[model samples]
Target: MTFVHWLAGQAGQTFASACVMTILVLMLFMAMKLYKSYRRNQTHLVLIIVLPLIIIQNGVLISLSDPEWSASPYLHIGYSFVSLLSFIIINFVFMKLYTGPASRLKGMPFFLMAIGLVVVTAAQIAYKPEMLSGPIAPGGVDLLALDFYGLILNFIILLNLRGVDQRINYQTSLIVYFVYQLSDMADSYVFHGEKPMLLIFIHLLPIVYYTLLFLLLFEWVLERLMMTFQSSITDGLTSLYNRRHFNKKAEQLLRDMKRIAIIFCDIDNFKKLNDTQGHHKADNVLKQVAEIIKEETAGIGTAGRYGGEELLGLIAAPGVKPEDVAEAIRSRVEKETMVTISVGVSISREGTSIAEIVSQADEAMYQSKTTGKNKVTLHPSVSQKRPRSESEGSKRSKQA
Candidate 1:
């Protein structure tokens, strides 16, 4: 068989492989997202997988097609421009959506500069459609322009990866794009040379790139897996560690046999806040409350989203008393949320279990809740009285 025929066959196979891997990986991610029951960001992940499939498939088609200058060169050029532009634009949107708007500042300029490269490539294709049929001389303007354009695009892909927060995603994308560019350059050269080994090498190029892409995709799957695991132990709306992690950590703290303090806090009339401001505003308020809680107890203590409208923090400081931590948090939360927190504290002496400590803490919380609100309650041993009147308790619950 001719070199061109062999190389073309390899290109076709590479494109097919990439398509297969993309479909499989995307389906796997979709399954993960569904299993985890996360409602947000699933669509974004789908777009990320689908957009590349389009670009890679188009590339393979262009590589295999025979060029005819007399035919609609303009149409082919337009198609090329659309393909490249679409890939870049979709990638930009994906980056921004996932990483936030600030990340776009760094990537948008790079993409804007790429506009010139796209224009040049399209112009080249339209002016000389025959160049599209086969590889160009390395030293020629057409090849030079295309190579330069590729360099810019590759650089932008890398730069965008760098700005992302997800470490595995960034590294995997970098590796995949790096190998892909290498295979792309090698394919160009093999097309020109047409040697027997080069034909085989050309066929193998897509396999390498596709394999790397698949690996990157698996990294994404792994990341999503990690996120799902993390979410189970985290508050869905506020992103703080959930009650499960809190309970586990509290148990560990108990086993350490050190004097530990537990603080239970309830957002004062959060139901009223939700009713007055609407759920969206209430969500923002919850996030703000979580942030303040996280900021305050960050290194010294462990905070957990103890179900709705409540949070728990465990401070393992033998020197600090339960009342002090409760007071500090209550004051700060009141200031930030413009709403009070009825805080309850329970301190466990050495050798106490987490369940016992929690039971004591919860009883204290109920006391605070019954006695109006906004006030702090200490463990029965530390404070005067525990129970409040049933009528008062019923009234407070009704008001809330």
Candidate 2:
């Protein structure tokens, strides 16, 4: 029995050493990453976990020096407790920032956690005044109670985010956090002393799973940030380039001296539709119509909703006549759906300003509305007399 106990202690020391090395390496990597992106939230999160781990390393080393301290068993459990607390606090802060809402608990849990940590820290101090002299008090009820409470609270915080559809990355992190704790707990109590080799191997399960999960969460957060950056330049409802993006696109076209066609479209009686259909159905219709126009102009131009019922498209094809592009939009608007729309087409080869082009298209669209609706009118510069000989121009002009 003594021989087996000696062997187990030896393996525990090795495992503790490996964890310490891993902690050092992670800290170095995190510090380097922080130097590159000072404001990165991830750098801050890594730091939060790292701080607790550093404290844990000190505790582990002390416990290791005096095997009589029972540090072998408590080393993993102690750090896991601290880690679980830190993770919960960090995750809660993230949730509040993301949703911009105060946490529901009114700070009671936080108070309890602080008290528990204080009790544990004081217990550690009593157990070891000096690393040179290993002394352990049989881990009283208060000590065990504090550790168990931390674990339960961590689990509660995890469960709270389950049904909420916010910060999916954080939610995933919480799940990984829970799994890691569960596995660590299992290996510690059930497998640690019985089979040192198997316990060491099983210990790696949580680490690998958590490492992979953490990487995936990093990717997800990065992707979300990119999406938010892109969304700032886009319209929320129509998924079209917003006025800001349109201005930027126009400026680029002007710089390149590219010929462009600007078409303005307004849902012919949109106000009436909204009044009749109610806001909900009206919103659906607007989305549907916007999608139709988007599909029609796919690959040919950039389409955007210019707020409310107004939609705009910018087509840049240097030699392709502006009037021809306008005609295409006009034809698509007519045949695409049963919903009627008045379209104004303006083609500019002179590298004109976006404002001037939009004004011209707006004027033409209004003219279409005044002249009995549901048709396309080309800008006055592009043979605006309705093709005196082509009657289809005049024929479809009255369909609206």
lDDT of each: 0.62, 0.60
lDDT per residue for candidate 2 within 1-400, as digits (tens), equals 4644444454545554565456545544644564455566653555455545654654554464355655434554465456556554544544433443343434465557666766775665477545324433333112444445556766777666633335466566666656655554555455544665554444444345445434543554575678887799888877778887877876676566666777788877778877877887767767767776676566666778777888887777556565555555555555664346777877664647778888888888887777766666787875546821113743554232
Q: What clash count goes with each model?
A: 0, 0
lDDT, candidate 2, equals 0.60
Name the Cα RMSD for model 2. Answer: 7.6
Model 2, residue 33: C-alpha shift (Å): 15
User: What TM-score would every model get versus the actual structure?
Assistant: 0.53, 0.59
When summed lDDT is taken over every stretch of 10 residues in candidate 2, the lowest stretch is 134-143
Of candidate 1, the 10-residue stretch with the lowest lDDT total is 389-398
